[model samples]
Target: MEYRRRTVLRAGTAGIAAAVAGCLGSNSTDDEGSIAGEELALATTTSTYDTGLLDEINAAFQERFGAQVAANAQGTGQAIESARNGNADVILVHARSQEDEFMRNGYGVNRRDLMFNDFVIVGPSDDPAGVSDTEQATAAFEAIADVQAMFVSRGDDSGTHTKEMVIWAEASSEPGGEWYQETGDGMGDTLMIADESNAYTLADRGTFLSMQDNLDLEILLQGPIEGGPELLANPYGIMAINPEIHPNVNYQLAMAYIGFVTSPEGQDVIGNYTSNGQQLFFPEALSDDPNFQQYVPDGWQPNSNGE
Candidate 1:
């Protein structure tokens, strides 16, 4: 699959400052020959950034390590594309199947588990499709399709869209009608579109929680809530772009980033981060906690070691 070029949304000014360190003569290089205060590019899913978790993590990482992180927020597919094109040193995304393919194609290395949340079906409170009664994601999708209710799709090749396609396939539906709409935008934007249109859409729990107060939609189906199916569990992972494939990549900084996010300190940050008094992500890296393990998919491994 050829990935088209797309603009990578930089995290903030702190990241951009690092990018111009050379011109500014900041002397950011360390004695150990590391670019301690140099810029590092990270391509990641929109949900992670839209929920404001990525910005929080980026702030901590820059402050603690004296390094600047330029995070490009996009869908998982586009994020991977950025990494593949050498536009990013590392990537953090939730599309496991796509990540597997990226690693297999030698575009990524040191792939490791990060954190997790779940996807939910959200629609207007009126429940026009009556999807609230469905037991699983597929059934809810079927109900929406059967009723010809307004359904908004991310339609941006995002992880959420990929999962929606799987559910639609399981329901034996192609999802085309005047009631179904596509918005080629991020999670937050898509949710707004759904809200304004009173349409049902699939969304990650974190993003939905972050924007719920502003949205007219309600959670119609949640994977963990109503004993929903396993497909709704959304696991996230991080990886450094392979320097071997693209020698111009900042492999050293990328490895450092991968190390930090998987470390105990990083996990704590993710686990403790909250919005509206609700926790958004649960850290599971190198953890044996059964509760976290339940969300991990079968045959899933932290790395090639299967740990």
Candidate 2:
């Protein structure tokens, strides 16, 4: 899959000065050379890039560490594949199952619970298939499937695609035929396709809200953020590519980037990022004890108390 890359270049002097002044409160100007002239390759989901959160946070990070960042936007599956192939130094994504698999395969390390949002079922404003009346996400999906209402799917094996498949499994409905359309694309493009087709689809709340103004879609069913089902909770994680597997990876820079994002400063930027007065991603790593279980595979320890 041809993934689009967005490089977070060093901001202008005024922007860098502003970040150095406050965004990174205690970092002195002398500390800029700590990772000076380094470029960290980041593999992440479209939601982060689409929502423009990286642009805000990377400005501060570049000023503080003097390292440029190239954030590649694509599906979670593609992101992981990039990391596994040693094309990216670090990855930030929301697919827990895939993350667990990557760790189990010894392709990544230093996995940190980074942030979260939720998924919402969106559709045409007229509410075809009566999706608006449904209480659960699965129920809404079932209704759409029942009526064979045109349902657009992010069929590119993304995190959103994984969640959509799960919901379909729970509803015991095989989504296919003329009613089910697969757009093997990222969240932003898939949404545009859905909107143009008058179709219902599952989307991350952040990306949806970021582009809501130009869309005809409405949130017919809420996710965890709106007091909906736990299944829709979209927790994201950041992990560094294990140097042992691929010596070419910038493991040191990756870990540094990880620390900054999970730090209080990083969490603050994430928590404060908003679209049209609505908070997008919530911070998940500020704590007395950091999450160590992210290092282990899922279900390896039944009492691990993780995620």
Candidate 3:
């Protein structure tokens, strides 16, 4: 089968962010895998969907497997919930902590570390809370709390929201009062809320870059790429819902989707995805070797037989 790669919005510094829904891959005969599993439901994060990464990757995936992907963009936590309820055949999300929990709860299996991108703190250019001066994310959060600076939170238990809470914990400050706010929305929407109110908010680098032109906020502090702390690193994972728990899901298609995304072809599509002349996600599924850690939760003790 011939792979017809779809194009993503690659603007200069100004990003023209829009999701790609065009048909990917050539219109040819359906393969056996495609015929066996024609529909694939994916529950994933808003960052992946809003940034249009899925559309680009799905193009290559369809080209190879011929499965039509229908992604339901939601918070990482909500996405997991959807999988647990048998609504999603597979999931792609960031928030490793949540991913670990999902695996622990026996709702997911065949976990694979897919790709990663770092997070950054974006806020008013004036640096009202002095977050611009902080090198570490924890200090930046403490600064925002000290000054009672306006801060908008996703508060939707999304990957971004989880990372924000972890930073607050490290900062040793309980964010409250009129300063901290919750939008209960996704990354793109929360970023807009912060921009609209001139507030401080933690955002994944890709989403912020894609929506930067429409935002007055500036990237005050960066993630690991800019010598920032490792705390801001955002790693995404792909997992097929456990069929033992829900036999109705298209497990075969789910695994095929996983294989395509983690394969050399999938990794290329992910690595090649860019917005505003910057790469959005760095592929990690194909490391030096097959990482079996994906099969277990983080810090799980390995037995002789491999639990």
Evaluated with TM-score, which candidate comes out highest?
A: 2
Residues 3-45 of candidate 3 have per-residue lDDT tens digits of 1122222222111011011122223343333333366788999
Query: By the lDDT metric, which is better: model 1 or model 2?
Result: 2
TM-score of each: 0.84, 0.88, 0.87
Q: Any idea what lDDT model 2 has?
A: 0.84
- Residue-wise lDDT of candidate 2 within 83-108, one digit each (tens)? 88888888999999999999989999
Q: Regarding TM-score, does 2 or 3 come out ahead?
A: 2
Angstrom error of the Cα, residue 157, model 3: value is: 0.5
Q: List per-prediction Cα lDDT, in the order shown.
A: 0.79, 0.84, 0.81
- Clashing residue pairs in all predictions, respectively, total 0, 0, 0
For residues 136-172, write the lDDT of model 1, one tens digit per residue.
7888888888889999999998899888888898885
82 in model 3: Cα distance from truth in Å?
0.7
lDDT of 3 at 18: 10
TM-score of 3: 0.87
Task: Give the true-structure RMSD of model 2.
Answer: 5.8
